[model samples]
Target chain A: MSTAERTAVTATRTRGLRRILRPRARLWLGTLAAALILFVVAPAALSGYQFGLLAQFLCYAMVAVGIGLAWGQGGMLTLGQGLFFGIGGYAMAMHLQLDDAGPGGVPAFMSLYGSGTVPAWWEPFRDPWITIGTIILLPAALAALLGYAIFARRVRGAYFAILSQALVAAFAILLIGQQASTGGSTGLSNFRGFFGYSLADPLNQRLLFFLAAGTLIGMVLLVRLLMRSRYGELLVATRDQEMRVRFLGYNPALVKTVAFVVSSVFAAVGGALFVPIAGIISPSDVAVVPSIMFVAGVAIGGRATLLGPVLGSLALSWVGAQLQDNYPSVWSYFQGALFVLVLGFLPQGFATLGGVLRRRKGDSR
Target chain B: MTTTRPLALEVTGLRVEFDGFVAVRDVDLTVPAGELRFLIGPNGAGKTTVIDALTGLVRGTGTARFDGHELLGRPVHRLVRAGIGRTFQTASVFEGHTVLQNLDIAAGLHRRPTTLLRRRRGVPEEVLRALDTVGLDDLADRPAGELAHGQKQWLEIGMLLVQDARLLLLDEPVAGMSGEERAATGELLRRISRDRTVVVVEHDMEFLRNYADTVTVMHRGSILAEGGVDEVQSDPRVIEVYLGAPLDAPTATATARATGRETR
Candidate 1:
């Protein structure tokens, strides 16, 4: 064989070796191991109520992970993810309502407040399969459309943030206005079962929590795989130097849209699961303030690190619950203070704490 | 020194307006493939503006044809896919990525159906060749943000190469470089131009005279002179544009010295 051919073979082999040796590969393995421990091993020790709380927290962490990808990595600050979250939650809630009603019967709420007629739009969700499909598709479709229009028009940065927040506000107002069909400000709740699994049973509740945990882990794994791909690098490139990415023959709009839509899907899935696990879906749960809180959790944890958003969201929610229990009025002040402190000092998030400590150790040596 | 190579870029009557102010006015230029052309002019003479217009970074009226295809309303990325590549005046690159990663991203430009889901092949042979061409193979793992200014410039050029760009539009590629860095860049530019058309917007007259096969001088948003470097240098209009006031022997030499690295 020619020397050139030999060199090419060597180059490809070395690249393969390099791919394995990269720090990201190690991190991926570590995350997988940790996920197993958290999802499979740790659940055995927790009480049913604690496990349910954990599942709900994981759902929030799921949304936070999406925030990290788009806001931290892709440089898209999606402040109104609650809109997609609401969409997913409502989709799930509507299906649950239909299932409990059992063929041609109006949901209990419709008889109570809504006119005794099921809305035409809610008809297709009667089938459990469509409900499951809509849980994934509805938010993805909306996000794709919104992302395409906004990104192609180059609406980004603070303007994009305001627009997204405005969308959430408008969505909440619309839900309120459609009180009869939507359950109004009260929102949809009182789900009886999930695909025939009785919610009243503690064992069934545990099963739901397991499903949420398993789905969250799967989503994280999917994100990890994507971040290692060529498209991941392009996403980061688009974030850092969009004009240069354009000159390199890439459509920045398409790349950003993909990231935004993926983020929306994650939020949608989180919201869908939250409905069953939390036993409710209300307008208040998906308002603009909740959307901002979602971003807050991501920012506090570390938007760029894979584990940061998950851990940060879990920690923030847990602490917020504790604070609300102990001193409800001061909880908001504490949350605001924490956000300010983190943004001011650890702008990269708490994930960088390890790196900072390591650097300091190196400096001393 | 002219060969029968086809024209890679043809622009005529191009004008760029920003609000009410015209940045580039009624410009006409053509570059044959496999040629190294220098665009030199005074500050704000619309050298970069013309490059922007051609690459579709700025909206302009007129005709720009690349390889027999009209290129007027196309987006920047489409122009890049159509074989027109560009580098910025300030050496724009993915600063967060490593040298190898930068090249890898550039090589993935032609990947289809979007970059999501499909994992692009890792560091193609072309990227390796580009890294070697720019003499940055050894520093492949180093973050690009930490590279020296000249190294960043070379990396950006390597990016264009890996994109298989047929027409390279470089704006002030060697600006702010040390003497040694400038010499190396000039050599690199000359070597890369052997297989593609390269248009460099520069301010250094001596470098143009030394390396440019053809030089086009812009004055007040229009082409003032175009020819072999020596011919354009000797042209009265070109000399007058350079000196601005009038062409006395001392003033001309002073202007040349002020532009830096004057050859004669």
Candidate 2:
């Protein structure tokens, strides 16, 4: 063969190989479908309660992906996704409670917190669509306001991190202090039905699981589309060099704010789905500790890679759940050790393992 | 390719001070469209300072108007948008992008908002035309970081070409180029001057003599002389500055004066 022909052959082979191995949307969707069928449908076939728990874990993974986008890709170091998550959970929880209690009827937690009468603020949640809409809009609006204030003033790095953490801290404190309006320390729980269907029924439980799975899959696709767009390049450029991007005729603050708002919306949606599957809404669920745990999973996966966040979140959550069952008290220490190990030895995360192995193979060849 | 237009750039009473020391003091200059002006001076003579002030990189207490728009206090991107493009002393190409991408970005200047809403299109034909001018079209796919020094210099010029600015500010465009590369760059500048105003700051006297339609000499934060290359070269003050001698006499005359004094 001529030199051109040899080059063409190599190009063809590479193209074919890429087609076979590239992580296309269909491939990922198919994989997710298969996993849903196996973990959710199969478990629903065998045991209903176990399926519900797995769905809850999937919700956590969805929030982890949001953390990855904000902290990992955009370099915002957000330790307050839990606040948005909680907003979503509470929005959905309020709506469910209202649906259960009917108009003017007080929820179980409202009487425990001290009021025999339903609050006016909880009245709007009587509309299921309004409550669901708030789940997506409330957190995004808050993020937009917060991100605008912080990024517009050029506050970034550890300062932004601290500010975000403070938001979550304040949120948890407010939830604990507001006993009359909110449930205070003991959250709104013991839900019975969602839109006239029994949440405890096996079919209803499976349906909730499917919804959570579908939401996660949808969020992943949305993020993938965003990352492949021109805005995505600007986002990455903002992370790498803000000044250069500014000189390149882009407003870095605006770009970062949009990404942060989008990430917050993702977290809210995840938290919204989390309520029905987990069957609880509390200050503890949206506290500072859980917020940090969300970031830890993304860091261990790889911030810049797509699948890294999802798999890392799922694996870490699974391990945490397993260890909690096996050792109970010692699991927290082991989790901390895992983070330190990953940070020290594999700072690039497990996603880069394939690249490392490829380099070794090239050297041998 | 030429028009009898007014000045493309005009600077009046340009003053730049850094930390209480005056770097460029009360300098005045102008370059008409389609004219090639050389800013020639010794080290620390504030030539680069004048260019930086013109490009909005340095704050100067003077009026710099580009096509009648005030340039001072405007940000760098705004200046670029106002039809003034510049090449740095050290090339500042985006290293991650391909050669074509760099040119494409330059071509996209002021035309499209660099947002996700804008679609990425095929490399504009003007980009290839620019590469052809710089003779880098063959390497369009290669990363800019991997180019040779001369190639990078040419690539920077190609970027400026695609920007199609009315005024081009170049700092030492041939600083590190080989002799052949220098000659090609001089030719390139002469050709580009057919349609745009070019203000070049260069220390290479030969390159300036070959390409500059007019040369301005700077000394101690001021314009010392302004004329054609031969006129500025033979100016007594320019000679004194270049030779590092006193303002009055040649070395031979000075030596003879000293001997006569010693004999007396």
**TM (chain A) per model:** 0.90, 0.90
Q: Which residue pairs in candidate 1 have backbone atoms (N, alpha carbon, C) closer than 3 angstroms, thus clashing?
A: none
Q: C-alpha displacement of A13 in model 1, angstroms?
A: 31
**Per-residue lDDT of candidate 1, residues A55-134 (tens digit):** 88888888998988898889999999999889998999999999888887689988888679998999999988999899
lDDT tens digits by residue: candidate 1, B1-264: 122243578899999999999988889998888799999887888999999988988898999888776777799888988888899999888999999989888877766655546775566788888988899999999999999999999999999999988888999998889989898899999998987889999887666767899999898899999998777776667667777533234545564564445444
Put down candidate 2 lDDT per residue, A1-365, tens digits, no spaces. 98545655665565577677765755666667856775556564745555666787789888887877776677788888999999998898888887888777788777866757778788889998899789988888998998988997789999998889999999999999987777888877788898788987877887787777777877777777777665665566578656545445445688789889988988888888888778888999999998988888888888777767877887888789879999999999999999998878668676665555455556777
Candidate 2: where is the Cα deviation over 4 Å? A1-16, A19-50, A71-73, A114-121, A363-365, B1-7, B14-27, B36-61, B87-92, B102-121, B148-164, B170-193, B200-264
lDDT of 2 by residue, B1-264 (tens): 123243478889999999999999989998877899999887889999998887767899889887879988887667777777777777767666678866765665545554464545576777878989889979999988899888888888887777666788889989888999999999998888888889999888768768899999998999999998777776767765766433223542444444447658
Best-matching candidate per lDDT: 1
Q: Please give the distance, in angstroms, between residue B55's alpha carbon in candidate 2 and its true position after superposition.
A: 5.3
**Model 1: residues >4 Å from true position, as ranges?**
A1-36, A40-42, A361-365, B1-6, B113-122, B244-251, B254-264
Determine which window of 10 residues in candidate 1 chain A has minimal summed lDDT: A353-362
